[model samples]
Target: MSATRRQMLARTGAAGAGIAFTGAISELFAGTAAAHGRAGYGPLVPDPKGLLDLPKGFRYQVLSREGENLRSGEGKVPSNHDGMAAFGGKRGGVHLVRNHENRVTAKIGVPTVKGLTYDPAAKGGCTALALDRRNNVIGERVAIAGTAVNCAGGPTPWNTWLTCEETEDKAGTNGYTKDHGFIFEVDPVDPHRTGAEPLTAMGRFQHEAVAVDPRRGVVYETEDAFQKPFGLFYRFLPKKPQGGRGSLRAGGRLQAMRVPGIPDLSSIQEIGASFDGVEWVDVPDPLAVRTPIRHQDFGPKGVTHAQKLEGCYWGGSSVYFVSSFARKAEGSAGDHYGQIWRYDPSRRRLTLVIVFGPSTDIQLPGESPDNICLAPAGGLMVCEDGGGVQHVYGVTRRGDVYAMARNRQNIGTPDNPEWGEFAGAAFSPDHDTMYVNCYAPGTTFAVTGPWHR
Candidate 1:
């Protein structure tokens, strides 16, 4: 590890909310004209492989590619690779559990096996991969099957992965025989033991992502609906997560967040404006049959609104979440790329750590910050799901944002490349490899470099 990185971790503790208050581009990425790259580790050198472009000393290799046969050889690797989590393998290397955000009529889905599915009619689920310490894929298989829109999820300190359904589709709705929109757990310690069960107590809404507090077993959830109606920031205090892996199913209390004095907190349009003394409102019924739990159950009860709460991560002792693209288009009051908020459970305080305003520049320091992973070296690595050319932004505990890697791949055409949204950004437990997914064509890359530098 570099001395510079060690100092950053020691000075700014991740346990509490720390942020770099500057909007300046990362000095590390200021590229010189001759090298066609920026400072930091050096400007990103264009990849001759035409997959990913990285800085001078760094390189990336495709870990998993779409259209490939599964390790079990039942179905092809599902497309629409969304959120993911990385864990230290039981034997060696890294174990990553990934989510496939498939819909009912999707062409590719998780392999359906007997005695291991929730709703066979549902097409979305999660898959697990085992990679060697060299970042080579050793094995891959389905972890959880038969769910819907398995979007973003977080890894538990207990060595399991929590995969969430982003849909509120009920059993009878859209040909689904079973109700959807619930959180599912996948144990990497034993993949076959991962059954098709939803943590129903978490609530049924347009679920986005979840962050589990390692100490208290409190699960922080985000809702991803349109902005006008907005979504709620939720917390599920598992009654007995002490039972381990599937304990959340034992039942828990579900609640929505509220700013003490604000009815619609989504409209608060200020960067770095802190809201202390955050309160929680209990939700009477989390499983809504006729309407979404957010629209009908909590809207009228003064629960605060968040335009589109997407990716969230639990680290140190707080939950960090991204409100992606809050604009009038999504029904939110104002327009901006995104906002990052931190909620400290112990203090009951919520801080607006970082906000990205309007920007057309593809190389801007901060864009749409989504899908966050707190690296072991200390600092948040964010996935960008916004428009234009995209890159993963590295954030300090104090909220200083910098360009870590840029996407130079061509999707639409060579003349007009649309950098697809970056998702599933997680660093390996050893900190030697960082795995992230490109939404289009569904590609997962193993990134390694002097991350400590």
Candidate 2:
């Protein structure tokens, strides 16, 4: 009768649900990499040495760093950097919206402007940085006040940042408001405004990143819960068309995905293989109504639990999503370490675009891909979440991959570099400038590339 019980019955048959106490296991355990077929692709480019390295003529410079003294007298830099977006710029100058993924850190001192402390541990959140024509930090301000674990988020068409909290526990461990997981709208210019509120209409979940569909007022969200079944990939369609401009408080429709014709669990295992093919069924009304088939249903058969779905963007006619981990099987030619999938609205299908890392035989050795962005030169730029060598990777539309820049800090060893993981890749309106964030050290970099065809 309940959602969980219905799902269990659907997977193991009505009769199997009663066998739980009879020592009969209805679930099948398969190796993580055994599902999904290989997608075709070759290596793109070798890793880079400098903080950022692009094709000839392209160069990058640090716009802001954690612990750096800001013009506002805020001593030291911010940590746990993530999602970023550039707005209101012409040629070289612009305003940047960035997220600080720190939940609680005694070293940073609760980030408050002047004499205000929203919480004893309000350090983890989002910030607004003003940049000059040359991509230099002129000023920085805390955009969305009193939020935690502000991770990867997308830019709205109306010029605002949708900062998402990566945790679900609102009543966080220390009895602090627990504002770790939820979506918040931040205005870069007036970040410190007292009326800013969290949008509970987005539904409370372990939100990782979000992408807004400007045309439809639809918000596509990704979750990062691994242990509790597969995380759900959701879409929030505001009740009133074009209603989510400066506020996400208006309730909306939330929907998940189903595999459609795949009646048996075994068929679900075959869906992740080849990228060129495969279809996804959209489960309408995931938040409002209960459905027997959910995204987590596919996890037992090696599916990356839809919760691992991270970054997303509206590219071409479809929306593309990135999976941080989807390793290949023991003897498969194509590796599944990670993959880029596209959801075609017109065709109502999902397709694999690029496969990264050794599993796909595409990445060098240890390249775990994360937040991605569309390049001005017609390609996708992916941030590496791996070791000391974490760098930004460029994958052309033609499937050719290359390393765009390095994270500047080595995360693999004990030294544990200060710079965090490179993430939230976004280009200026003109595509001439690229802005990236380091997740660990919580720093932001602005780079100018030589535009060459």
Candidate 3:
């Protein structure tokens, strides 16, 4: 690594949740772009292959492509790859549970395997890819099947993947035989442990992602609704908190977060602004049999709502989540390009860590940050889901931003040239490789480099 990157890493490791850390992040969002250096590897060197562009010393390998026959011979690889999680496997290898965000009408859906199908008519779910220590794909198969619009989910402390359905399509609607929108657990190591069963107790309505608090076994979830009244941040209090696999299936209480005076998260503009005494309001109906969770009445002080709530993960003692963006034109109460909020369970506080752009510049580091994961080298890797060019960004602990990779392939016509969004964004168990997926023409990539220790 360069001296600049080394210093940045050292500083990131030493920084804590204090004034210094807050101020650095504030400057980043306040348009003081001059304060940041190329804290990561360096500027992205264009890919000669015209696919993914990465830094000079970095390289990426394509592991799977949509429409291709699976090695397992079950069917073709599914399309619209989304959320994912990586776990340690046998002999220092890695296992990745990946989501296929296919709607009921998609041409190539996750293959239905015996015992894995939740709804034979539904066309979305997850698949597992086992890679050797050197990152070579050894096995791939359908992990969970027959779910709808499986978007993004978090991993459990006990070594399982929670695949979420990001839809509200009910039974008999659009050919769905059962209610969609619920979280399902998948065992990447043991296929027998992954039964395609939905955790119904966890309120459903377009779930985008989830974060599990290891200490309390609470699952924090985000909703990505496009209509007015948007989506709410939720937490599922499981009856068998911390019980190994199938615990969530036992059912739980679902509740949404409410900040005293703030009705919408997008209204908050100040970075490091903390809200204390945040409360949770129970969802009267987790199943959304009639009204969606966010649309349901939460008594006097209504449940707090935010637009484009996506990407959530637990780190340290806090659970961090993202609001992709908001606009008054889009029925949002307030406007901003993106916001990353951290909530401390012990203190019951929610603080705004970073906010970026209401600008037209797609080059802004915080433009539509989605599917975020804390980098092992002391930072956060954010997948950009905004307009123009899409990039995977690295935000240092001190809030410096750098582009880690760029999507250069044009999946659309030459006149349109559409670059699909990047999703998943997980690191291998060994931290030597980063794995992420391209949502269009569906593709999975394993990236390796001279990472900073």
Top-TM-score candidate index: 3
Error at 210, model 3, angstroms = 0.7
What is the per-residue lDDT of model 1 for residues 1-453, given as tens digits with 9 covering 90 to 100? 221221111112322222333221122122211111222455567788778877778888887877898887767888778898888875568888889998987768788876568898888898888888888888888888888999898877788888889888877887889989888888874666768777888888889898878778788999988635788899998889664877888899999898877655556645456787898888878888666766665545477887778988765567788887676765666665677777887788777655664444555445567787765444567787766878776665344345677776667877776767789998887677789998767788999987765
lDDT of 3 at 345: 85
| Candidate 2 C-alpha lDDT tens digits along 1-453 | 211221112122333322331121111111111111211122222326435434455566777777777556755557767888889755557898888777665345325654223444466666778877877777876665556677788878778788887765545565666444567777776665423466666756667787776677778878766543546566777776575455456676565544344322212222233232233334433322233223323433322234256887765456767666632332122234455555655556654444444322222222466788766655456787764456676644333345566555544465644445788888887667888887655567777755323
Q: What is the model-wide C-alpha lDDT for candidate 3?
A: 0.83
- RMSD, one per candidate, in order: 6.4, 12.3, 5.2
Query: How accurate locally, in lDDT, is each candidate?
Result: 0.74, 0.57, 0.83
TM-score, each model? 0.88, 0.74, 0.92
Least accurate 10 contiguous residues by lDDT in model 2: 25-34
Ordering by lDDT? 3, 1, 2
Q: Tens digit of lDDT per residue, candidate 3, span 1-453?
A: 321222111112323333434453432233222223447776789888888999898899999989988878999999999999999998999999999999977879999999899999988999899999988999899998999999899999999999999999999999989989988999997766768878889877899999999989999999999998999999989999966888888888999999999998888866667999999999998899999888898998998899999999887678888999889898887777788888998999998877755434554344788898867666678898988788888876565567789998898888878889999999987778999999986999999997653
